[model samples]
Target: MRRLLFWLLLFALPSTQAAEELRLTNGEWAPYLGAQLPHHGIASRIVAEAFALEGIEVRWEFHPWARSLLLAERGDRHGSAVWLSSPHRKETFFVSDPILDSTYYLFHRKDRPLHWESIEDLAGLRLGATTGYDYGEPFQRAEAQQSLQIRRLGSDLLGFRQLLAGRLDAFPMDKVVGFDLLHEQFSSAERARLSFHPRPLRSDSLHLLLSRRIPQNADYMLRFNAGLARLRESGKVSQYLLEAQRPLSLGR
Candidate 1:
């Protein structure tokens, strides 16, 4: 009789006691995801807001980009934010609709004059890139084939400094990010010397990808997509990104 009573009480308990918090990991990629920026930068705010719309709270872990994606892929974390899609990632994780479209550009000194019609055109130059960045399949394959000369450093800041010091021939990054960092980190005179090639290297959409380890990963993607659509309809997504793009004083 006591056992029967315990089962009845347990069954009667409300299952909706509280919503489980979703975990995500990423690192500082400014004007996109930054712990110091408002709403933790545009991408962070979008991810948080999307989950919030579904009554889910987010628990974010900021770490290096490669490590963060690895955790999510391993199911140590539920999801990862603001990442470009790749064949391996598609096979490994459930990806949602694109959160943002990013354009990759090659930044170089104005005096050097750099141009590229194809990845082949960049073969001999010492290309500065961040470690573990997904520069798309073409660039990766070329690097693997030893068709491109690649020099990797810790961060864009390091790469930019290397370029300034003539240690790197060219550095590639998102145009918006390069400009923002240029504005934030360089003096007026320094800014004048830097410019990006007119042609874009590649344009790709960034998405929030869910780990396959989570049994309900697909459902989570659906919820996030719906929330993202709603946010788009409400114009919050555009507004948020524009806010992040506000110019910062180049020199303090």
Candidate 2:
């Protein structure tokens, strides 16, 4: 009777548990996702607020882009933010709804003008690309076929440095990120010397990626998507982005 009473009392007790904490990987992509920016930039801000709406707390760890993906895929972290989705990533991770949009542009020196209607036009020209970055399937195919001369650098900063040094003819980078980095890292004269082609290379959305190695992340992605939708409906996502883009002293 006592044992039966104990079981009844246990079942009657509240089943509610503490909200789970999620560890998410991030990288330094300013005005979007960065460790130094206020609230770790707009994308990270949106991620936190969205998860907060669902009663999940997030802890962020910043690393290089490649390492960030590795950690997430291994489930060392719950997920990573702001990655362009690809087939391999889709197979390995549960991709969330688009958190931000990215537009790619071919950046080059103003004095060294370049015009191209297609990938073939870029043959024999020196181009800089970042390691572990996929511009697109078309660009990839061209590089693989040896139709385009490309140099892979470790980061966008290095690519820009190569362009500035006249060692690279062109570098493809996100329009927003290119401008943001120029403003933050270069002098006024340096910024003036560089420009991006008016024609965009491509446009893609950035998404949060949760590892498939963790079974709970499948459910997390659903909750994240739902919360993201709410944030979008509330118009806070746009609001956050506009606020982040505002110019400030020190460019933090």
Candidate 3:
């Protein structure tokens, strides 16, 4: 009876299953990624929910943009979240399906009134670029060939400040990120001083980069893409993005 009761009690107890966790390196790029933002911002939220559908949890390690890439490349972490796809990156990592879209514009001070219909138009002007960022193929080629005068900076905020100070003629930045920074960091008067060219520098998709060093990541990539498709089909992705924009609008 005692042995039977022991087996019965074991069967009666609830089962505890440990969830699978994936660690990804991250950086602060607000409205998309920030350690303090709700769900760590929209992109992070989407990535997490997609993985959740596949019964995996995400653990994000916050670092500088360059360091984040380094950690992922070295396999110190599982991968990096929210990076633009590039040929170099493709060689080092397995790029996932598009997680978000980003449009780049050349931001300049309103007083300067910069005009550029093509990459060659602004050749002589001082341009500010963030370190470890991809501004697109045309811009990259121009910079490499010394056709454009480019200055590499540490962050987007610093690049914008350079533009306002007249040190930089223009800075390439994401349209949404540029405005968000202006709204968050500058006064109304300061905000009024900044503007972006109507023409976009480039439009690119953001993707999750899983490390090539991890053999299992190949499988993870397949699972992530499947889960993402389901999330999109359910219309939750658009709903969540629309909801995120509401707070930004209210703050502005």
Q: How many clashes in each structure?
A: 0, 0, 0
Q: Which 10 consecutive residues of model 3 have the lowest summed lDDT?
A: 243-252
* lDDT tens readout by residue for model 1, 208-249: 999989988888888989988988888999988786663533
Model 3 Cα lDDT, one tens digit per residue, 14-78: 88878989999888988889999899988999999999999999999899888999999998899
Which residue pairs does candidate 1 place in steric collision?
none
lDDT of 2 by residue, 83-194 (tens): 9898989999999999988888899998999999888888989999998888887898998998899999988999988899999999999877787887878877887787
> Between candidates 2 and 3, which one is better according to TM-score?
3
TM per prediction = 0.86, 0.87, 0.89
Q: Best TM-score goes to which candidate? A: 3
Candidate with the larger lDDT of 1 and 3 = 3
Checking candidate 2 for backbone clashes, the offending pairs are none
Candidate 1, after superposition: displacement of residue 192 in Å?
1.3
